[model samples]
Target: MGKREHCRTSVLFFPTFVNRFGCGKAQCTGVPSFRIGHAGFLDRLVWPDLNRRLSVAKETIVNRSNRAGQIAELRKVVMWLYDKGRYHDALPGAVQLVDWSRDSHGSSYPELADSINILAMTYHALGQYDAAEPLHVEALELRRRCNGERSCAVAMSMNNLAALHFDCGKFGKSEELYLRSLEIDRNAQTLHNLGVLYHAMGRFAEAKPLFHEALEIRHEAPGENSSSFALTLNCLAALYFRMSDYAQAESLWRRALKIRGRVSGRRHPDYARTLNNLGAVYYILGELARAERFFMRALRIRRQVFGDIHGECAQTLDNLGSVSRAKGRFKKAL
Candidate 1:
């Protein structure tokens, strides 16, 4: 097998080990699994630390124009920083690039508009909705001017704008934008985002197909470990669990758990989500012993990663209570 294929094969078995040992007790923190000796998104990508790359990308943006090559390279660098979880640090560089790309007097105005759209995304991640909204609007205008409403570029801007709307609880606006984006690409990410939006709105029936579609796409994609794919898997698993599809749910959650082990490592707070999902599946499967074990492990991880009182910890604690009750440990359940 090729190097990438080999990695994927290993990823496939990673969760089985996690199910056996339970994510290492010491591994839980906000840090991703890849950073903890497991190769993850950051390691898979070429970019270095967020702060360092931000500086370099900013400098490159200043010296370069809106030329296709420069713009593409700038995007690559900026995206890499975002994927590394350096949302805040990416902002300054992204803003500078947006400024250059948006200057109507320059030949690069279209590029600036595109850059602004990208900036909108980074801002959305950092919870700077006010900052992101205007950029999305500006990008929409530019895209319309350059590519018309039906073009793929317009669709891209719409999707980002929709995400912003979703973040702000504007489900209608977000839905409209996602539908528009879907018309253009019908891509996995757009579908996944749509699934999340639907889930948030309590529309599970509408959400499941999108999650399933994204999972299939990820399964076929190049990487063995991806946060997006793992997330989608978790979503599907949770959905199945909610519907009492215990067998399917357990299978999916177990798969997702392994990916989290390999991609996010055993200790990240996100891993707790996988653990909780898996624990719930075990609970439903009437494996109280296994359920209690997973819940306690998740609880410890959450406490270490998020400290006491975080919502996730509370949920983990509750799961522990449930498992205890199921085992007839009344005092512990209490």
Candidate 2:
């Protein structure tokens, strides 16, 4: 539902991610006492052992010693990748989960529906909206069948479909479904998404309170320092940015940057959004050097996730071009 993302690097180069346990001689922007630089976040810490984790899960599935528990372990592995912004890596496991669930359970089983949502959301994260939509529709139907139309599961299904519509610029459809979901359940996610839709529609005055209320709800449930809270903060910051309240926007986005980094990490699209937003703020303040650094970091992350021509990368490139123009670097601007 969000372009969720990582790192602090100087303007001239990419950030060096070292071991979190690197020698405490040098300090950089990092998590607590562990500096962010060369933190080996994914390579040494997360990804290095990922194959082993996947292999163990696969072996358990093959052995079928405890089929339900084995599949749950596989789901956890796949979700771990998905949650960490490793959508490309998670695709195979997600597909396998759906396939196995359908074959072993049934077409109408709740497990299959849940697997489909995971796969669909992963596709959504990758900007494969078309691939995600039908799966969302199928999952919604399955949810209605399995848990009844008015159940929380169906509401979640509606919210997922709504977010996809919102991403696709189907504001009216998105609003309809979001409102429907809200009627069924007033969860923080649906409320935040609705606020985002209103923000996009230029109904800033209407959007403001929804964000605030959602933030309050999230504060109560997930507490103040969760990814859900960060998302709401990011959108609220974006709203302030649109309203030309630069200081407030920057302040709010700064909070989101720290929170997302701590919870979601830097290898995510959402983190890139925060970076790009901060860069825009700096650009507006005529801080070209600062703006360039943030833009370059965001651009690199977007390229890694979506490649060069994708909309997110293109947006960052355009921002960089504008920064060059502002600095009278006409060749770079062109």
Candidate 3:
């Protein structure tokens, strides 16, 4: 077999092994039955320990008689892993989901579209944007085919594609999609995403009202203390900080931080993000000591969640270094 075909075969059979062996804790103890000719491909494509466990236990999950139930359980596991930030581990399962859906019903099936969406999301999370965009495009087309042009499903797909474009720095395309999505449904998430895009483009005046509208929608729908509401508040705080309104920014950030803390705890990435932003505000205000404390706390939490070399951890390090320099601790800053 060609390299691509061999790799595909490996992924396909790995799940069969899992299904037959059972996925429970005790069921994963045996040796994996399937083997890939290109070991490097497996190493590069899958998380080692997770792939082994899944390969052993995926088969015993449900009988061959209950295909739908098996797919549902697999989807749940894939989403759970994705939620836990195990993006690499989630990718294989997402691929299996798409394959199963397509094989059972056709490429144009609704379940195929859903699986494609999950696979795209997993790729996006893993920073494989090139791989993600085409899948997202396919998913959008499938959703439109199945649900009509102006349906909520189509609008959601637009928003997701917009997010991908925004992340890729295609601001024009992102804005166009966001506008289209807004026309279909006045959703809070779409509004907040547009606000974020505007903020990134330095269009603070245009961003502020969008953020406000999003916050209002969230407050009305899910209440003020919801994580989504806190996210909008954080975005507004960032805009205020950019405008040099330090006092206003600090107040907004603190409120958002409190809400995030209550909802997701201080260890959550959102809470750490707020802490970092608050530290920057304090640093700008010449409260070096207080800024250092916040930066340190943010660094600790980011290290716990994302480890030492991630963007967030690096940003906190930069801020801490600046504070040290301001305090005349040249050696420490270095």
lDDT of 1 by residue, 150-196 (tens): 76566656766776787676889889888876776665556767776
TM-score per candidate, chains pooled: 0.63, 0.83, 0.76
Single out the weakest 10-residue window by summed lDDT for candidate 2.
Answer: 21-30
Query: Please, what are the lDDT tens digits per residue for candidate 2 over residues 110-139?
Result: 887877877787777667879989988998
Query: What are the lDDT figures for the candidates, one per model?
Result: 0.59, 0.67, 0.64
Give all candidate RMSDs, comma-separated.
Answer: 9.2, 10.2, 14.1
Error of 2 at 312 (Å): 1.7
- Residue runs of model 1 more than 4 Å from their true location after superposition: 1-43, 48-77, 103-108, 264-334
- Model 3 CA deviation exceeding 4 Å by range: 1-57, 60-63, 84-89
